[model samples]
Target: MKVLLKGTSLLLLILAGTVMGCKSPENASNFPKRPNILFAIADDQSFPHAGAYGFAEIKTPAFDKVAKDGVLFNNAFVAAPQCSPSRAAILTGKNIWQLEEAGTHASSFPKKLNVFTDMLEDAGYQLGYTGKAWGPGNWKIAGWDRNPVGPAYNEKELTTVPSTGINKRDYFGNFSHFLEKRATGKPFFFWYGGHEPHRVYEPGSGAKAGKRFKNVQLPGFLPDDSVTRNDVIDYAFEIEYFDAHLLKMLKLLEEKGELANTVVVVTADNGMPFPYAKANLQEYGTHVPLAISWPDQIKSSKKVDDLVSMIDLAPTFLEIAGIKSAPVMTGQSIVPVLFSKGGENTSKRNYVLTGRERHTHARPDNLGYPARAIRTKEYLYVKNYKPERWPVGDPVPPNDENNKRAQTEGFKTLFPGYHDIDGSPSKTFMMKHQHEESVNRLFKNAFEKRPEAQLFDIQNDPECLYDLSGNTEYSDICADLRNKLDQELTKQGDPRMFGSDIFDSYPRYSPMRNFQGFNARGQYNPAYAD
Candidate 1:
């Protein structure tokens, strides 16, 4: 190798071939050989929402540039649709069912589940994150000395956000701080988890931020009223705000001459926080946008159509960093596809499994709506374990008088108890227009109790409006997909399949509200109603 440095010590080390080959303390690959990593995750955004995906309402130049420079995955998914478990799967490379308490939303995380961030830190990589690393759950209870995602870097704050809904944290400023504090010559890893486009947006903020309601696209399940359209625009505005911070961070990397070598991955934890999305395990819920850039190795401006999961992220990082992935990780690395013929359907993956347990403490007895699913290129099969229970929880608690539980605990449940979908103008409009026949699909698709199994031809009906589970024409296809989903769940040892109570046993760490449940015959079930 040519001696690129002028110092005598550098010349001596290069002349001594043995010294040139000597490994770092972490038994790491050469520091320059391993690229600096920046993983940015947006909270509560979904697929087909970014500008790179051709949505004009949302401006995401930073995410689009990453796609322009490297690979954009069209079929990427998360292990679970909710936040904590989805993020856990991304960091640990395992499904939520495989993780104990970490699997449940707002539940205590068990100490046994190790994460990739700690692995990178142990490998002598400076690791840190800003804004929403991991959850409504308490990680401290799991015996973690710090947040499992990384050490926090959210000390820096902004005077105000663009709107009332936008987060005030200085995401790029904190990332810059992380870079400034990093060890010299050491490859660094930073997680920029942006809390944007989630909920509680300033009313009409999207219109205020130059978003056009006419440009908004409404899913088949959502009513296309003016209120809903305006809400969608507001969501777009927050997404753009998140993208703006990402652009600044990317510019910093380019200014520092680290853009080409640094690996950049941009994605979201789950679907948009709207009715029939986010908490539900439909196509709109699990199918999220993913874009990656590793300019040093992969060619520019290509797209991949293979089925992939966020769980694949940890393994991919380990693979690219020249480190062996732990055996416990179930996800496969995308490195092979990145180095191969970059064409649609050229990737080896055929199917990606996704599922969920509890999301919020929204039901009576703190019960959860459990579901599992498998998505193939042609179809999506969903298996709901509890069909008897309300999927999104009861729309309203029982009307009661002089009942302390109803008075004190009915705050979140009194108006609309389907606590899974976020409360917003879209949701409120849908609920208000439930009586209208044309707009009632939103209510039926989102709030109604469902069958034990559902089959949707994702090729033709990505909206999942037509359920083919009972149709004779699709029986064989449904059977094959159901079998595959069960087989994977069995292999992963999911408690929902085996009827384990460990999921319900994990105590919720977030705020609780007691709810009254009705009997099968419509009478209040006093056992829980009190």
Candidate 2:
């Protein structure tokens, strides 16, 4: 009886050990043995454009599928309004102001900064990017032998008319090739940057392709005309085209049996290119779509409205890959939000900040309108660092014969029926009017001087049509936001907020303005008069 009892005890102990071994702490990580990453970025896509974001005009099945299966961030914002600075922020996980040249449009990224690709490569992961990657500038000085995407990635060739050629690098095709070349067991990260939906679109590309202009929804700032509608349709056509390629990439991943383990992130660098959109610091300008998917690990689909920024992407990627982020990265990882419990509170910030240094080469001395903004749920407060400079840029007077002739002819063709048109016909019509009153107001709205501080009630004025800076009702909120922003700037060691003379001491570098030997008008005028 004693022997039998001892045997039974041993058997029970073996069973318990087996159960404990099967449910180890290692299983809690839920990380794949070797998971792949695919980060697809669009050139100029704004929020609510993708079908997943609730826009019916364009169908983005691949992006929608990811959102349906994973998580969608409804309030993700980019660090800057333009392409280069915004992309730089995503790469470095630092605000644009922290990066010197990389903060400006068409500027060369400094070699010293640590990018995510470098961190991943150091962590024993294969990294390569196809299509646009840290571009519109010379990359050699940035310590890159090739594009920052990777050394193995293929270059995409341009396809356009002789005079107006477009960069037609097949981003999807390159991504497929990158996946095929990766070792069977090694994980790889690929950046699929699509240069679509940007400006200089092919006229009637939408109509000829069966897209109806009537289906387009015009923004309140733009006129409700065929030209504007057609422009939007053309924009949608490119978006659809981008989606088609994205679908192809997803199929390739699935066929390779890497779909379940792969983490796919779909987003854009900045807002859509429009009159009051792309270059500005409005909600529509900095607000972008962000969706992520990881089927093997992520259990449910969730829509998060927490305030997130493009700067957070780097840290998140590193954390997922079991790699530590560098010390200088200002962004915090959002991994908790991704795999949070139902009742988990994972909001990192109550507000998001964005700014700009230089955009286009339209200003005197190539000086851009330096503005910083802080956006909360109900309000947006902007501080124009240089109110004396043009808000848009210095405007070239229409005194030249050709400009004058174009102005006269454009006005005549725009308003043919009215002998005396009162109250500017529309945005397009006002563009042709060269009169001082008409021109002054347009410039004031677009390029003239602005106040040092501006406030907008984004809830009511989504387009930021009215300025409530002078309103006493919002004065307290404005002051609080301003104080918060100043504290942040001080923490970041910005000289402007610290009241230092660094602004006057620093040398100005013109990347977008003079890098390509083009003048403010985008013409190849060889006069170095500036």
Top candidate (lDDT)? 1
In the range 405-504, model 2's lDDT, one tens digit per residue, is 5355432221221111111223334355434563444334543466888898878987676778888998998899999988776566443453422222
Q: Estimate each model's TM-score.
A: 0.90, 0.81
Q: Candidate 1 overall Cα lDDT vs. reference?
A: 0.79
Identify the runs in model 1 with alpha carbons over 4 angstroms from their true place. 1-32, 344-347, 397-413, 517-530
What's the C-alpha lDDT at position 404 in model 1? Answer: 44
Question: For residues 366-479, could you state the per-residue lDDT of candidate 1 as single tens digits?
Answer: 777889999998998999998998888766634533134545644333445677777787777877788899777668888889999999889899888888899999899988
Evaluated at residue 28, the lDDT of candidate 2 is 28
Question: What lDDT score goes with residue 505 in model 2?
Answer: 18
Global CA lDDT of candidate 2, please?
Answer: 0.68
